[model samples]
Target: MINQSELENSKEVGIITDISDKELHLALGLSDPTCNNEISQQDQNESTHDTSNSTAPSEPQLFFQAVGLVRGQYLPSTEKLGSGILLLDDGVIAPTNLLASAVYTVKKHPNLLESPQVWIVYPRVQVKNPPFLNFAIRGARLPLEGEDAEVINQSVDDFSIRGIVTYTNRKAGNFVIKVYRNFMPWKEQEGTKYKPHIFTITGVLPSEGLPCGQFWDLKVKRVADQLVLEDATFITQVFEPKKPKKGRSKRQGQKRKAKRNQSNPQ
Candidate 1:
């Protein structure tokens, strides 16, 4: 739901280092190449850039879109003054300077966390040696209501998410969903026996709307990173306890009363 207008102002654009058919097929769950003929045709037409002469081959650059839950703004310790921390989608706790701007933006606008459906735009450049993906948030914003979904979908190069909705501001037109690393098992003291050890890729939708407690399954896709509402479903609902109001605890009140009685000696 990122507004089209905002994308123009975005500073960082994503890059696709590798778009091989096999990779695309695995990522998008496409059974036939004909389904994504546009991407395949484009790939076939473009000649591979030779990197031996240059520092690195210039790859296709596009905006990468992802829905992330803003766990919270990280405040670095005194020793690491400028460094910042960001808990991104899939429980990946990133404590680095790369997300410094994103962290500052979130801190400046605390409201972003309220509707934690944060739209992250970054370059998806793959590092050669370590085989790690290095991403930097170029821009981010809360999705607007009645925004053009088609425009947002077309701009991004890739999109993948699996998480639970932490917050929802339907009036503002967005909801927060969190993602977890794959193969991470679900841990619970009581429900361990019933649920599977690892999370399921697909889930069932019991009701309508992206409720706060619902666990979403957003994996299946014909085109890489193009999300379809019909394909998105919910696995189950999670009921979280309401946070207690800030104040003195019952134990503290009792201790205060005891201190008063001791001083008064009535």
Candidate 2:
């Protein structure tokens, strides 16, 4: 008979004597001695793994990273609106919609809007109903005017924008434009296709009506809670032209004639 120590340490015969129930289960290709225990342990491991891998939901973003130039403010008893242009990092200039709290804070510290500064904004969305998004400023700070800022600011002062009129709210007398501007001359690469930088511009509608899908060059100024359109010049109408029906090919025509002759036999 084999010695007890030799049986416990046996390798060739695969005997695992004097081992714990957990080790015995492992040796027998079982996760645990009992099915319930195995399931419970697997569930626990999955729970732990899921908990470790899960992440908290992030807040919505209203604007990309950029510097804001505060141009107008409205402080009323019930509401506040800070209107300005956002100098985006991608060299696009767009309008802003500030929240009441942000407007109040900026009102208290008027200097925050005196010059170009980086603004942090948070987006609020409603669970039910339209116009659910709300953009609120969290804070602002003066930028160092580094190379990036300088490059973005180069086209900020004077530049032409071409955009489509995306939205028009008649009752609200406000509209939104999707503007596209070219990058700085130096930033453009040779031998590569050119792509314009794009951003959205929210402004008040001018006295003249602006139908949707019509392109226009608008003169806007910061006012109240949005940019007010001072004037507008029509550019061109954009629409999907109806495609003409394709004619039948010569082989298809012949096949159709053959089918017709077979059907009528005349």
Q: Write the per-residue lDDT of candidate 1 for residues 135-235, one digit (tens) a residue.
A: 34533644469887555544333335454554443333334444322211223243232221111122333344435545555533212212233345555
* Top candidate, metric TM-score: 2
lDDT value, candidate 1, whole model: 0.38
List of clashing residue pairs for candidate 2: none
Q: Which stretches of candidate 1 lie over 4 Å from their true place?
A: 1-158, 183-210, 219-231, 240-266
lDDT of 2 by residue, 1-266 (tens): 22333223212111111233343233223334333322355655675556342111121111112223332222222333465544443334444556676666677887765555555543222324433332345555334556465553432222233444544545434554543221122233444443322223354444354355455666543333234455666665442112223456688899999999999985
Model 2 scores a TM of 0.26
Instruction: Give all candidates' CA lDDT scores.
Output: 0.38, 0.41
Q: Using Cα atoms with residue i matched to residue i, what is each candidate's TM-score against the true structure? A: 0.25, 0.26
Model 2 is weakest, by summed lDDT over 10 consecutive residues, at 55-64
